[model samples]
Target: MSSVEEFRTAFRDWLRADLTGEFARLRGRGGPGREHEAFDERRAWERHMAAAGWTCVGWPKEYGGRGATLEQQVAFHEEYALADAPARVGHIGEQLLGPTLIAFGTPGQRERFLPRIVAVEELWCQGYSEPEAGSDLGGVRTRAELDGEEWTVTGQKTWTSLAHRSDWCFVVARTEPGSTRHQGLSYLLVPLDQPGVEVRPITQLTGTCEFNEVFFDSARTPAANIVGTPGEGWKVAVATLGFERGVSTLGQQVGFRRELEAVIDLARRNGAAEDPLIRDRIARAWIGLEIIRGNALRMLDGVSAGAPGPEASVGKIFWATWHRELGELAMDVHGAEGMLAAGEPYDLDDFQRLFLFSRADTIYAGSNEIQRNIIAERVLGLPKEARP
Candidate 1:
C-alpha cells in the first residue's frame, strides 16, 4: 500500500480495536457547543492515545512524535474522525503551541515543553483575544514586565477556550513599556494555577462554558518562557495562528460530513427531503463542504513549505461560513420544532446545539470581515482599509 493508505488503515484499525469497553461510550462526545460532555473522560482517552504514540504524530521524531508526513497526518485525522473518536482535548497544545515552539523556541524551552505536550501532561490555551482586541490582535494591551528572573503578566483575555481546564496559557503581552499595536509584544507562557490568574467561564447560547475570560493580575512566568525575541512576539504569535489552520481541520471536515449526513437523514425521516427547495439547499451544503476540503488541501501546501501564509485565511473563511450555514440548514430542516428546547430547563437536542453554537464559527478564529480584509490586503495587493 502507499504510505498514506497504509497509515490510514493502521490508524483505522487501531481506533476500531481500542475504542471499546470503557472508551466506547466516548464516541461523539466533547465537541463544539458540547465541550462540557465527558471532558474528564475525553482527557483520559487522549492520554491513552498519547501513551500509544498516537498523539502529535506530525512532530519530528526528536520531539517525541512519530514524524509522520503531511499526507500521513491528514490520513490520521480523517480516520480518527471516521471512527467517531471523542474530540481531542489537547489540540491547542499539540497543533498550535507545539509547532510554534518547534519553530521559534530556545532549545531549553523545547526540552522542557515538547515532551509534556506529546504526553498530554499539560494542556495549554491561547491568550490572544481580549475585551478590546478580538480580531485585531495588534490592539492587545496586556502587558508583561521582567522583574529579576520572572515576567509579571497583567491583563484580561476574553474568549479564551478551555482556560479553566488548561495548565498554561500562551499570552501575547506588550513587553516594551511604550509599545502599541503589534510592535513590542512578547509571547509568554504563563501557568494558570498561580494565585494571580483567575478564570471565569462565560455561558454561551448553547448553555455551555467552553469559553472563558482569564484575568492575569501580576501572574508570573520565568523570563525564559517567552517565545522568540521579546520585541518581535508578533512574528511568533502570527506563526501560531498559521498553525491553528493546519491539517487537523481535515478531521473536523469529516465530523462536518457526519453532521451533514445526520441532517440529511433527519430531512428524509421528517419528509423535508420531498421539498425540492430543501433538497437544493442540502446539495449546496454538500458542494460547499467539498470546496472547504479543497481550500484546506491548498492551504496545507503552504504549511508544508513553511508556516501557512495569508492564504490560510481563505480556508478559515470558507469553512466557518459553511459551518454556520449548515447550522441554519439544520434548523430549517427541523422547521417549527427547531424553536423549542428538546426538554424543560433549556435542554437542547444536537441540532439545536449545533445551530446555536455554529453561529460563532464565523466570528471566532478571525471573523469573516477580518478574513476578507486579509485576502484583499495581503493576498490580492489591495489598498489598505481606512483607519482612524
Candidate 2:
C-alpha cells in the first residue's frame, strides 16, 4: 500500500480498538444517556485523542500537533464518526478560538492557550451573538472601553452555548463608539470566572440548559487579551465565523452521516423497509450526505493548497438542510416512538432530541439565510442588498 493508505489503515485499526470500548460503555448506559456526564466523558475522550496525537491532527507540529496531512485528517474524522465517539465538549475552543489563535495570536498566546485547548483544561464559549445582534453581527452593541492598561467590557451576549460551564469566552465588542457597524468592533478574550461576569442558563424546549446568556458588567481583561489591533475585531470576527462555518461543519458532517446510517438501520428493522417512499428518502439522504462529504473534501483540499474560499458557505447551507431532512425522515420512520423522551420506555426517543437540536444548525454559525446571501453575493456575483 502507498504511504497514505498505510497511514489510514493503521489509524483506522487504532481508532477501532479505542473507540469500541468507549462506545460500548456509552451504549450500555441506554439510549443517549450522556446528558449529565456528557462533558466529562467528552473531556476524557479528548484527552485520550490528544495522547494519541490525534486531537489537533491538522495543526502544525510546532503547536503540539502531529502535523498530519489533510488526507490523514479527513481519515481521522471519518474513523471518529464510524466509532461513534462522543461529540466534542469544547467546540468553541477546538473549532473557533483555536484556529483564530493559530492565525492571529502571538507566540506567547499560542503557547499559553493551544496546549490547554488540546487537553480540554480550559473550556471556551463564544460571546458573539448578543440579544440585538444575532444574525446581523455588524450591529453588535457590546462595549469594551480601554481603562489604562485594562479593557473593561460591559454588555450582554445571548445564546452562548455552554457559557455556564466555560472558563473563557472570545468576545466581540465595540471599541470605537463613533465608527460604523463593522469598523468599530474588536475581539477580546474574556475570562469568565471573574466577579463581573454572570452566566445564566437558558433552557431549551427540551428543558435542557445547553446554552446561556452571559452578562458582562465591567468585565476586566488585560490589554494582552485583545486579538489583533483595536478596532480590527470585525475582521477577526469574520475569520472566526469562517472557521466556525467551514472547519466545524466538516466535523459535524461525520456525526450527521452516522446518524443517517442509524436511521437507515432503524427503518430496515421497522416495516418501513418495504415502503418505496421511505427507501427513496433514505437514498436521497445518502446522496445529499455524499455531496456534503465531497464539498468538505474540496474545502480541505483548498485549505491545504492555500486557496481557501467562501465555498464553505455552500457546504454549510447544504449540510444544514440535509440534516433537517434526515431528522424529519428518521422521525417519520419512528412514527410515534420518535416523540418519546429518552427516559421513557420507547426505543427511538433519541431521534426526538436529535431532531430538536438540528433546528438550531441553520440558525447558529450565521443563519442559513445569511449563508445563502453570502453565496449569492460572493459566489454568484449578484447585486448587493441595500443597507439601512
Candidate 2 at residue 155, lDDT? 96
Segments of candidate 2 deviating more than 4 angstroms: 17-36, 246-251, 305-308, 342-348
Q: Top model by lDDT, which number? A: 1
lDDT for each residue of candidate 1 in 52-125, tens digit (9 for 90 to 100): 99999999999999989999999999999988899999999999999999999999999999999999999999
TM-score of each: 0.98, 0.90
Candidate 2, residues 13-64, lDDT tens digits: the string is 8776777665446421211222444566667777877787767766788887
Candidate 2 global CA lDDT score:
0.78
Give the whole-model CA lDDT for all candidates, comma-separated.
0.94, 0.78
